[model samples]
Target chain A: MAADKVDPIHQFHITKILPINVGHYDVSFTNSSLFMAMTVIAATAFLILATSGRSMVPNRWQLVAEMSYSFVANTLRDAAGKAGMKFFPMVFSLFMFVLVANLLGMIPYFFTITSHIIVTFCLAMLVISTVVIYGIWKHGFHFFGLFVPSGVPAALVPLVTMIEVISFLSRPISLSVRLFANMLAGHITLKVFAGFVVTLSAAGVAGMAGAVLPLAMAVALTALEFLVAFLQAYVFTVLTCMYLNDAIHPGH
Target chain B: MASNVNTTAEVHHGGAEHGGAFPPFDSSTFASQILWLAITFGLFYVLMSKVVLPRIGGILEARHDKIAKDLEEANRLKADSEAAGAAYEKSLAEARKKAQAIASETRSVLNAALDAKRHEAESSLSTKIAAAETAIAGIKAKALAEVDGIAIETAETLVSTLAGESVGRDEVAAAVAAVTAK
Candidate 1:
């Protein structure tokens, strides 16, 4: 195995430059940052083109655009209730951005930010932070009471509250891990099978004949991964909506 | 063929065991992950809100308008059909009434024609009866005159034969008067 391939953790690398050091943090942009910027620009251009003309009766492109809106809108309404409307734009933007990113990652040689755990973790952290801030802002200090269930006996309050707080704190870790693991696993699976096709073809005639099954499997898995990509984005958005619901209506 | 060969290679080598790609978590990997997460989140936010949601809403509203217009058109057609049905019924009834009036008129005309024919036939029959009565009266008068001449001849022959001699008219007249008296 090559030196680069032998290093287990070295697969994920971050290069830092001493361009201009901020007071506390290293805010230098990297390849990942560049792709993130590209994703945003691409997303903006896509929407602008889709809704260039505001027709009463939408064209095929506009129809697709509207369906995406209603799907997210209804999802938020169902999961988060009337208060969800306040965060509709946020949740909508989140779904669209993730969906595009995941789809873009499927393209050859495109950098899939979602495949990285740090990317997923950061998003989860944002949601968790928003939940905490919104909860405290809406309920004041009483937001701490969220960990204590209503109608519970005083004797169990401490234990119950500890459990609730642990669960709440674990949100970012679990959310990030779920998405990162799925994206990473799916892509790696495709690559390994792809690698087999090359290696087998290079071998004898028998190896070439044997490559057909894995190639077929890889094709099927790729299609499935596409579905998974869409589903994960949806699940992430729904979870965000549910968490926002907690902030909107605490105590339960 | 190559795809098949690749399958055996991946299976034999344990494709899932590509463990080098993902290893234990470390500080650098963690930081990179967070940075990517922030970037992706921001990108998604703008795309959905600005582009996707509005387009979806427009489609839904347009569909709703289409459905509503279709229903309105259906209602109008139903009303028109009902009106047409009523008009058809009215016209049918008027035709039936006109048919009945024509039938009654025809019956009256036929009856009047029959009465006039009966009256003409009766007048012609009465005129023929009157003409026959006049002819009979004329024949009866001629026959009475002839009978009077033959009765005188026969009486004369009978009186001569009975008296065996020529008898005068006064004697015959007296005999006829006696017989009449008796």
Candidate 2:
């Protein structure tokens, strides 16, 4: 097999289209940046244009836009309550970015932005920082109360507090890793199964006949990857809402 | 087609020049990814907050207000129709009552005129009958007196003719009267 055909990691390569160094940082415009820009632009255009008519009885695209709005709105509201509605813009942006980025990645030869740990980590940190800043800002020192469970026996307070602190601190890592790993692993698995088909079919008639199994498996995995794409985006956003809930309520 | 991108994540692209550093784990890409994430996400947040949300929310609120106004208008029209229907029913009942009163009054007036005519006709007929009865009584008395005189004359003439002798009118009258009396 050719070297390019052997490397699934090649899909994730951030080829620099333009180099733009800011101070000491290598903040070049890469393929990753390209897809991120596309995701936002596409999302923005769809939302803005879909509602342009402001039709009482919405058309098909308008309905989709409205449903997306209400869907994320309800997700945030359910997790964080009415007060959480204040973070709607931030939460909604994250959801749209992740969802669009993941689905865009499903296209052949397209870059999956969320597949990178740095990207997902930053998105997760956006959520975590918002939670910490808003929680502490709103509740002052009382936000620390989120670490202490009210119903726990006094004997286990120290132990439980330690566990809560670890869990609380691990939120960004877990959240980021969950989405990044799912996208990276799913795409890799699909590529492997699909590669088996190509490698086997290249051999001979007997090997060509054996190629159908992996080919069929690849087809099913593609379908499953599409689901994973959407699911990971949702998981990331929903976890974001839950973390934001800690900011609004702050009490266990 | 993405399935054809090869398997084995173990095979890192040697061309990337970052050596064995995995693309995701590569810290060199982090700066750009973070920078782009901020820019794109910031733009999205601004667009959503400034334009899209307000427009959609306005459309919804306007629809809600319109629906409420329409319902209030419908209720007012219903109440007006009911009032009109009640007035129609009341006037119809009054007209029916007036018609009944007029009919009764006309019948009473007709009956009174008819009774007066009947009473005058009956009284005039009774007076004429009483006058006819008195005249008939007078005629009957005169006839009876004439019949008595004729009977005395005939008796005198028959006696004279049989005896062939003259007699006094006074004596003949006395004899005839005595026979008639007997």
Candidate 3:
């Protein structure tokens, strides 16, 4: 069996589709870009087409559309109260994009956009920046008060403040890494198991029988990946809501 | 199928090291990925906030308003029916009172009329009884006078026959008078 020869990480390779050179930057359209566009198109089409009827009693498609909208809206309201709703569009976009991208990645030979740290990091950075900018804009210098724990003794204030600031700043790093690592690990695990099935089945009758175990495992992992896809999207959006809450109401 | 798998595996192995070590770590595609991400996400956000969300919100609002209106209409109708029921009960009570008054009035009038008729019948019966008693007394008195005359004649005849002689008129008349007077 050539199990060791199979490379699971090979699936994440990016290929250039259309090259666009701008003086110093190599901003060529890639497979990741295509899937990202597809995600946007799918999300937009679902929302627009479903709501076309706008019936008081919604159809199945309209129900799905409404559920997605309210899901994010309610999440925002719960996490940050009514004031957090102002960022609904941004949060909704992030959720749908990540959700679709993760699901698309589960398809054989499709690239998982969220698996890339660059993409997830960019999204996380966006959330963190929005929180900081909006917090400062709304609260002025009082935004710094978010670092100081209210009940802490004066002697330990400096230590607690430093730790708080560090934790607050680590929000984006942790958020982006969580989604990226989950996708990357899940996809790699599925690929490794699938590769085992392929290599074993090529070895003859006994090997083909042995391949069944990995095949079953691959199938199960695929199902788990689907769940992780949804869960990660939820986790990402909810964390974004909590961060936005800090922007709206600092120090708590 | 075996060859296909072999070739794919070969390509994967061949591509692993040279193509890029962990494609995400390759800094080359980050710019394009971020660029397209921004573009796509921006467009999605705009469409959501400007069009789709508002439409859904409007539909929900419309349904809520319609339900509230229907509820209000139902409440109003219920109130109207209750008022009508109250009015019907009031009229029924009034009618019953009116009927009772009329019944008592008619009963009193009938009782008065019956009493007057009974009094007239009693007075007429008493007068008729008095007249009948007077007539009966007159008849009895006449019958007694006739019986007395009869007795006196019979006695005179019997006395003359038994003696076998014609008696003198003054003696006979005196004898009849004494017998009748005794």
User: Any idea what lDDT model 1 has?
Assistant: 0.73
Question: How well is each residue in B1-182 modelled by candidate 1, as lDDT tens digits?
Answer: 55565455445333433422343243434444455456556656655666556655655677788889999999999999999999999999999999999999999999999999998999998899888888888888888666655555567779789877877766666665565457
Best by DockQ: 3
Which candidate has the top score in TM-score? 3
Ranking by TM-score: 3, 2, 1
TM per candidate comes to 0.72, 0.74, 0.82
DockQ-derived CAPRI band for the predicted complex in model 1: acceptable
Candidate 2 runs further than 4 Å off: A1-7, A21-24, A196-228, B1-12, B71-182
Model 2 C-alpha lDDT per residue in residues A120-238, reported as the tens digit of each score:
99889888999999999999999999888888999999999999999998999999999999999988887787778877887799889999999999899999998998788789879
Q: Runs in model 3 with CA error above 4 Å?
A: A1-7, A196-216, B1-19, B85-116, B119-123, B126-182
Off by over 4 Å in 1: A1-20, A53-60, A132-147, A150-154, A249-252, B1-26, B29-52, B101-182
A113-138, model 3: which lDDT tens digit per residue? Answer: 89999999999999999999999999
Q: A55-147 in candidate 1: lDDT tens per residue? A: 776777766666677788889999889987888988877777777778887775566777777677777887889889999999888888778
**What are the DockQ scores of the candidates, in order?**
0.23, 0.33, 0.43
> Worst ten-residue run, lDDT, model 2 chain B?
B3-12
Model 3: how far residue A31 lies from native, Å: 0.5
Cα displacement (angstroms), candidate 2, residue A9, comes to 3.2
Summing lDDT over every window of 10 consecutive residues in candidate 3 chain A, give the lowest-scoring window: A1-10
Choose the strongest candidate by lDDT. 3
